[model samples]
Target chain A: SQQGEEDPQALSIQEGENATMNCSYKTSINNLQWYRQNSGRGLVHLILIRSNEREKHSGRLRVTLDTSKKSSSLLITASRAADTASYFCAFFSGGYNKLIFGAGTRLAVHP
Target chain B: GAGVSQSPRYKVAKRGQDVALRCDPISGHVSLFWYQQALGQGPEFLTYFQNEAQLDKSGLPSDRFFAERPEGSVSTLKIQRTQQEDSAVYLCASSLAPGGFDSPLHFGNGTRLTVT
Candidate 1:
């Protein structure tokens, strides 16, 4: 399967703490993306990193990609209870035009 | 502007019944995708449409699953002879350009189907 694998299936943290999740893929990819989904809601796009880029940052969120290792990581700084959701990593491979998603990491931030 | 819209937030059907789900993508968006998400798992790719044309459907589980985007705006996914395994959330997403690139997808809340 071209599906990536996310590390730490679940994570629990307190508000104001940092949370990190990692994803590993099996094939070379064009780009990687992160998404967040609240319970019973659709996924919201968070960030996208190309295979040539090493890292990218958005407000309160940082993503790093290592093509040599075929892995990527997402870090949320000063997380809030509202940040609690499932985080998924999806990637597009060379031949496929669709993004393949991995089983997500469920995050819980307690207030 | 409104985001992607899906009709029939929830549906319950008996085994062997047929069901159709609807998706209204963001206006002017050219790419549409369908995914099936089982509980506690990641969303699985089902099909993709660029405008009114279906470019890739390799992820569709079986011939029983059918999808179409008649006018390059609204799309439908129809399932025949539903089974328990078909119980899942059907998600629809659209992008400004063709997918698998830098364009991020805009998604709908999705329709949950339950087969008994």
Candidate 2:
């Protein structure tokens, strides 16, 4: 499957704590993107890190990409209750113009 | 500006029936995509369109599924002989970029289709 695998199918953290999620893919990619999906809602784009970039940041979110490892990670700092959502990693390969998403990591941030 | 919009927020269809889902992309967005997401799973790419041209549909599961964007602004996904396995949420997303991976996508709330 072209789909990537996300580490820790689920995670729980306090409102003020930080949460991290990892994703590993099999093929080379043009860029990797992270999305957050609230229950019963469509996904919202969080951040994107190109294969050539080692890290990128957006507000409280941080993303890292390691092309050699074929892996990427997303970190949420000072997570809030609203941060509770399923986080998915999607990689766009040159071969496939569309993004392939992982199963996702379900996160629960307790207030 | 309005975001992507998908009609019939919810639908219930009996097995063997045909169903059509509609998506209205963000105005002037050059790229649109359709995805199928099962319960507790990530969205799976179904098809992609650049303007009115269907550039890639390699992710479509079978011939039972068909999608079109004739005028390049609105799109429709039609499922023929719907089966129980076809029960899933259909999501539509549009990007400002033409056909590359550089831009982020704006997604609709999605239409939840239940096949019984």
Write model 2 residue lDDT over B1-116, tens digit each, in one string: 48999988999999999999999999999999999999899999989999999999998999999999999999999999999999999999999888747889889999999999
Q: Which residue pairs come into collision in candidate 1?
A: none
- Candidate 2 chain B weakest ten by summed lDDT: B97-106
Candidate 2 wrongly placed segments (more than 4 Å):
A94-96
**DockQ of structure 2:** 0.69
Query: Over the stretch A9-108, how does candidate 1's per-residue lDDT look in tens digits?
Result: 9999999999999999998888899999999999999999988999999999999999999999999999999999999999875455688899999999
Candidate 2 global TM-score: 0.97
Model 1 residue B37 lDDT score: 95
Residues B26-105, candidate 1: write the lDDT tens digits: 99999999999999899988899999999999889889999999999999999999999999999999999776478898
TM-score of each: 0.97, 0.97
Q: Which digits, one per residue and each the tens of the lDDT, describe model 2 over residues A3-104?
A: 699998999999999999999998888888999999999989998888789999999999999999999999999999999999999977545458889999
User: How would you class the docking of model 2?
Assistant: medium
Clashes of 1: 0
DockQ of each model against the real complex?
0.71, 0.69
- The per-model lDDT (C-alpha) reads 0.92, 0.92
